[model samples]
Target: MATGLHAPILDWYAENARDLPWRRPDAGPWAILVSEIMLQQTPVVRVLPVWDEWMRRWPTPAALAAEPPGEAVRHWGRLGYPRRALNLHACARAITAEHGGRVPSSYESLRALPGVGDYTAAAVASFAFGGSHAVLDTNVRRVLARAVRGEEYPPKATTTAERKLAESLLPPLDAPRWAVAVMELGALVCTARAPRCADCPVAAACAWRLAGRPAYQGPERRGQTYAGTDRQCRGRLLAVLREAHGAVPKAALDVVWDDAVQRERALDGLVADGLAEALPDDAYRLPA
Candidate 1:
């Protein structure tokens, strides 16, 4: 009688999982990994076309690793978080050099790679390697919090207790699909702002909904401000560099932002993060 939430969620997912490209039976592990990274904080609609282009250009980790990081940055058009592009490029290189161009199978080896954080590591391990680990992305956390723990929302970050609770609910057999099922539920049904509770598979057992589905009475989750922030300045600077095939003049970048202090700080941050390199003549370009 699958007392907790994982069983019914997995069953529901089998019947209702979205036909996402990355979830296809023949999709390679590298492709799945790329999808996971791109899907971070990015919408599915935006990711689909970019993902297709990315896979066509760089079919394998070795393919991406062999190319200059500049190409990756150029390909990451309008993704907002450009650093994720740099990290992903570095991750490909690490996979090529260390894992013989194959995405690693074990959680330890996958987690050891550059930019392969907890969520990514778990995702790859479960989806690619068929491990029974619970891949707790934001969506999975929210669904579990509401359906099982009776919380209106999950925490700001993944907690140890959350992982334990999720793992405890993971059926020992075919656990990878179970993880995907819960995540799919969150994505398609149990959405962030307005969950389709009427169609939720486990609504009959949902603790939060049974408790009258009270609105999130606590202080609302603060949205991150993007306009006029340093992140915007960084975006401006990167746009100039990405457009240039070779090193770009410092004066050319200076035109993008007016504030000398903020612009310089953003550039410095880019250089510090290894996404950009200061050339011999104070020009800047994506790292070779």
Candidate 2:
């Protein structure tokens, strides 16, 4: 099954992969690492512009390390999770100070960087350095769940079984290409909501399709709601700080959200998260 699976998916990817800049030969390990960080929970379309701008502005780890953390957050620009910017900034500093301004090649070294978890570390190592590792991201998880396990969806959280399954399917040679091919297949064909089974290269051999495409029977999956939530309030407050050249008055932040209590709470949360700074004069700004 693993041997049969690799060829068609790699063939399909060769014919259909998107021409993202990060995939280019000249993109380097730094570009691939930056793209991996920015692509977290954000779609490729949104990440493209921000990535291009970031590459243009700070092409290397040392370049970004020299900038203030707040500058990273400011440039983050409505990416939804501003803390990732801080994480990337922290990673830049660490890479510069410890690794001599190079993105680490090994999964263990990459995983030690701030905000880089198991999936991210694996992705950077595999995609950037061509190190063979099981990169079980959401897309790959979904593909494995349906094609191998005959399940409509993977569990809400990764499991040991899932990890072992992913590891088992990894080819001995050209594993990095195989990894990205399966990921692209999941992203384009075996989607979570509406999988185009007809378009999937492995559909004929897919366990789920052979079993009549069973519905997801696991725990209910809930979509995140952002409206009027503390998260929304935090984004509103942070937007004001991101735009301000200097410390913004409390009144400036207060006007973005109507609920004074929620606004204040969100502001406090930002400061606590190192996304914002509070002045003695009651003004606020992005972390310096």
Candidate 3:
């Protein structure tokens, strides 16, 4: 981070940061970890209520670990990647059996847990424990790209240089707060679309602003299509199972999607992904 930009960003964040449940002082490592995982691809508004209810229902790793994975998937709701819920359930059990039912503090330990990766580990270590780790999430990456690298967007995939950039940006002290402040600045001021540069704290030092903000020209950014796709089919099939208490007849699933090939493929995909189970009589339901 530019030395001049540091104070402005931290000061702006102090006044404008969202009062998300996960950011409260009372939220523990488990709550913060859950919020990070759930917030990965979902919007904040969608994640808030679900997180509150989830934390209420399973406050600790042991509480969630005591339940079947099916219960976790069911409770996951429409968070998009329901597989993350399964990973969380597996992670909870690992924490219970290995870390004495507590979220591990080290980046390595958190990364070793199911579905936990470098970004997730760094985020958990920094946000949950106030550790000095480079939290290079999408927002932080974008902020660095525009402000430091003079680019409209970060490289589609993270690079060694990106990690180095993030590490170099860490403040000498209160690195955790600095990391979060930059992340919030990106999320709020330097957004992907409609950035509020005039109000941005570091506008004067931003390389993008100095260079006259340019449009991304690397590759064609394509949006994902969901209608009539396998994902939509999966959602439809899962919706039935999520609402069901017992095995669902094959005929019931048949009505959800018209294309027999795509429907069966989606159902098979769900079972293959461990989001659902097939019974002996060809009926299906969420995994037991």
Error of 2 at 177 (Å): 0.4
Which has the higher TM-score value, candidate number 2 or candidate number 3? 2
Residue 235 lDDT in candidate 3: 93
TM-score of each: 0.94, 0.98, 0.97
Q: What tens-digit string does per-residue lDDT give for candidate 1 at 1-288?
A: 335566677778878988999989889899988988888889899989888999999999999998988788889888768777877898899988888889889988888876678889989899988897878899989987888778889887778988888877778688888888888889999998889998887999998999988777655788889989999999999999888989999999999999999999999999998779999888999889
lDDT of all the models against the reference?
A: 0.86, 0.92, 0.90
Model 3 C-alpha lDDT per residue in residues 55-77, reported as the tens digit of each score: 99999999999998988889889
Question: In candidate 1, which residue pairs get closer than 3 Å at backbone N, Cα or C atoms, i.e. clash?
Answer: none
Model 2 steric clash pairs: none
**Model 1: worst 10 consecutive residues (lDDT sum):** 1-10
The alpha-carbon deviation from the true structure for residue 120 of candidate 3, after best TM-score superposition, in angstroms, is 1.1
TM-score of 3: 0.97
Off by over 4 Å in 3: none
RMSD of 3: 1.1
lDDT of 2 by residue, 1-288 (tens): 467899899999999999999999998998998899899999999999999999999999999999999999999998879999999999999999999999989999999999999999999999888899999999999999998899999999999999998898889898899999989998889998999998888899999999999888988999889799999899888998999978999988888999998888889999999999989889988888
